[model samples]
Target: MTVYRRGLRFLRARRRAVAALAAWSVVEAGQTFLVGYALARALDEGFLAGRARTGLGWLGVGALAVVVGAYGTRRVYGCVAALVEPLRDQLVRHVVARGVREGDGGALSGLTQQVEIARDTFAGLVMVSRSFLFTAAGALIGLCSLDPLLLLVVAPPLAAGVALFALTLRPLARRQEAFLVADEEIAAHLGGICPALRDITAAGAEALVTADAGARIGVELRAARSLARRGVLRVACLAVGGQLPLVLLLATAPGLLAHGVTPGALVGALAYVTQSLLPALQNLVHGLGTSGSRLEVVLRRLTPDPPPAAAGPAVTRQAAGPTAGGPARPAAQPRPLGVPVCADHPPARGPALSVSALTFAYGPGAVPVIENLDLRVPRGAHLAVVGPSGIGKSTLVALVAGLLEPTSGTIRVLGQPVRGRAAHGRTARGGSARIQPVRGPTACGQRVLIPQEAYVVTGTLAENLGQLRPRPVPEAELRAAAEAVGLGRLMERLGGPAAEVDPRALSAGERQLIALTRAYLSYAPLALLDEATCHLDPEAEERAERAFAARPGGTLVVVAHRISSARRAARVLVLDGRRALLGDHDELVERSPLYRELTGSWSRADSKPALAPRDPDRVDPVAGPGLAGDRRHVVAHGPVGQMQAARDLGDGGTRGREG
Candidate 1:
């Protein structure tokens, strides 16, 4: 659906509140006319008839009713606005949640602007406009009821005034739309520049960036001036268009009175004409001026309503091949491929992870990022995924973490499917991330993935560390996480992260360390470190690695580019062209060419020959939990035996390369 249609849906959702506000608006308008007429009549007839006190009392009663109506209307207005807040928040949350998976931009900012505009204009100014309309309608109806002939004199000019105002303001509306778009561009430009101004200075490109900003501003200024001109011309047209006919009416009023129109009727007709024409003309001008931009923004923000929720694989079947048949049977749900089974539920303990036939692509047609990728990470294992850049190493981590869905595969963390990204194959920006955040009661507090980039929110360091509100982590625990990542000294060097005062005050490394602390706080059974220590020094990186290794019960999946990190891994999976070459630190180093080239030493333990498999049914004591339980399993088949078996499957085979 288009944004405009979605906006209408939003309005429809809050119809009751809107209706309440609209009802009061009409009541206020009618009362306003009544009070005006009553006062006018009291002065003209009662005072002129020498009954001043009675006339005054009649005016007071009319004034009192108007006061009460307006007061009640204002109260109702507040209630309507309050009711609309949740609707606005819901719209924003939808956009934010979608953005996490889809990486779509502009929706969040536009939603904020639209809701604020609605609160300021639609929720408030609309009441006034509606009041004006109803008030004018009542006065015009009363005037016509008193004397139908008077319409002939007032109707033509008022219609002309409205028509003329509309004609002149059409251009203004188009210009305003263009101007508003340019204004948004300028805001985005400034926002981009503000945070990274130091880089421009360091690079000596300040003049170039400043010139770019100036050019954009110049464009905005020109459009803004054009809008101003249109506004002025519209106001001028309203003045002349409204006044010319009113002047004629006033000039003819006395003559009309003498020509058999009663003076009281003439007076009332003139009052109605003035009241009816002026506000209508003003509203026509204002509507053309304001509504277009507000609406354009509102329409841009609202996404199409989602299709109805479907059950399990049925949903995917409907999405994948709708014409194929009746509802497709749900795919056999696999157990976890990694630990920290639940993000919300506190885990009994972290567990090691394993995957088989883990294959996934972006879509049906694209080549898979991971293809039949298989790995066995023992319980409490600290393994690193080392590959040349762009080798799908990080993507593998994402898949294992359940952040991406496999095209054909199974991942078992402590013998359960990953609860995060993998199960549904969703990215953060597509609005699916929130669902993955809490998968099931048995799945909570199972695993945490530390992304490559660091994020710091606008609050205290404590706030940034624990995304969950009411901050479950204590100061001591937070300090320990900081120290474990070797950021404790950095914190002290910077005078304490808790008192660091601002995220801006820290460097990129410090920010990344803080993010590490956040992941550590999650205490998941499996921690997938996707370049999580990319920012730390060698000593600090080792310190962070130890922290991951020491985490209770969870297996550690580390994706690293640095050879130092690879050497530290108990087992390293070398990926090249989306295929996995798995072996221990020493075994892979000697046999795999890619390992040697990356580490630059054939004799290094990281470059050892791939290990030959041992006999079937001979379990290593260190392997823990064997092939049967929640722990990762090395199949009883010898290394060479399993390797041949995997090759015979006719899927991609694991091959060690000579550098």
Candidate 2:
């Protein structure tokens, strides 16, 4: 259902309170008319007459009824206000949930602001409308009963005033909307400044950012002024218009009384019309001017054509088809523990990744970040991707991490298609597999990403690390992870593993170490290090690279900007623009011009071609082999020699490294 329809439903559900309030307004309007009529009658009859007593009783009764009506209105408004709090709360929850689900924080924030304005402003507007109609109807009926001719006096001016308001309100609303948009931009700009402050100051660009923000605020102020001017003009017209009829009545009432109209009737009708026009016009102005504009903003924001829902029964039915290269079958209904995953049975205990022709674009109109990308990392192998900045290197890493979907083609985690939704659940192939849909450690329970900046929140080190799971990781495990990456000494200097190191005091490298430690704590089958080493020094990089190399089973896809990092990888993939190719570090250095340019590999003089490792097994069947490189030994085999051959290869320094 449309949001406006839903909102209307909500207001309608509170019909009991609305009815009570409307009833109170009717009583109040009736009392206003009665009081005016009583006063006019009393004045005309003269106070010493018995008619004065009758009029005084009505005046007192009218006063009492007004008090009761005010009290009832306040009570009903309170109930309505209470009802709306929960509605605002619901909108907040929807926004939060949408942000977490779709990663659309900006849109969610806008939606939340719109819903709040609607709730707060709409209630006042609806109430005011109720009061306005009550007063206008009561006044018109009383004036008609006294003398229908007065309707002619009020209607023409009231219509003119309404037309004037409507004509001016369009520009007022447009200006108001523009001001609000600018104000929101200013707020977002200020919010973003904290992250960019260091960069801005370092680049001497603080003035530029400040100037930009000031310009936006200046525009907002101008628009606000324009809106205020229009509002003033509208109010001026409404005020003059309301009083015109009253003035006309005063001049005409005495003449009508002279033409055999009772003085009591003329005065009573005039007073009633005066009382009604004053409050009714005022409330109508408020409703149309301020509240009306705010409500329109709310309605516009809340009534966006909602995107099609991504989850539910219909999606499940669609999932029963050839997806991820599997035959069609009914999707299971059981929700996964985390992000939902659906695919074939993953190969038992294989390397954590495979990608073939993985193409992805951020949006429909944007250029494909990674086009026809092919990458594979063997089980327990470390591979680094290096390229120039903006060469889609980060995009490639994100794909391997499974944080983003390929626009076309396929990605497989351990031989299972990592397409559609990835998590552990039923697949179109009618089998269950563990696929982590969302990016993080929980998916497949063995994947982790150490993002570049390594965010640190305001909390104890333990608490930040503890964000990985509900429970705190043991100190021993934390230390082990830290020690694996050369953070042991730092941890020791900072009062050991239980140390409550304030993140603010730590150097960038130190914070990065903590981030790495968090990643290390996850025994994921795959790890994507996206510039994870950027903040580290050479020594720390060496240590971290070694630690990553030592990790077994999981595939390591590293996006590195440094040649030092490329040298440590079993293989290096050079991405130039949207293209990628695989080769050993030196092979890529020699072959790929982009790689040579990036690493300054051409600078080396008289660098000899590195020799490929040799297998001596084919050389001789019986004879024992001689040593080759450092700490090398070789042996050859036979029936008794077979035993010797096993010992020889094991003792030899020929442990293979595959690229």
Which residue pairs come into collision in candidate 2? 341-422, 341-423, 422-437, 423-435, 436-443, 446-524, 446-525, 638-641, 638-642
Candidate 2, TM-score vs. the true structure? 0.46
Q: Give the TM-score of each candidate.
A: 0.42, 0.46
Compose the digit string of candidate 2's lDDT tens values, residues 403-491: 45679988776665654334321111100111112223232244566755455544555654544442465555566666776777877
Q: Which tens-of-lDDT digit does each residue in 530-554 have in candidate 1?
A: 7666445557777877777776665
TM-score of 1: 0.42
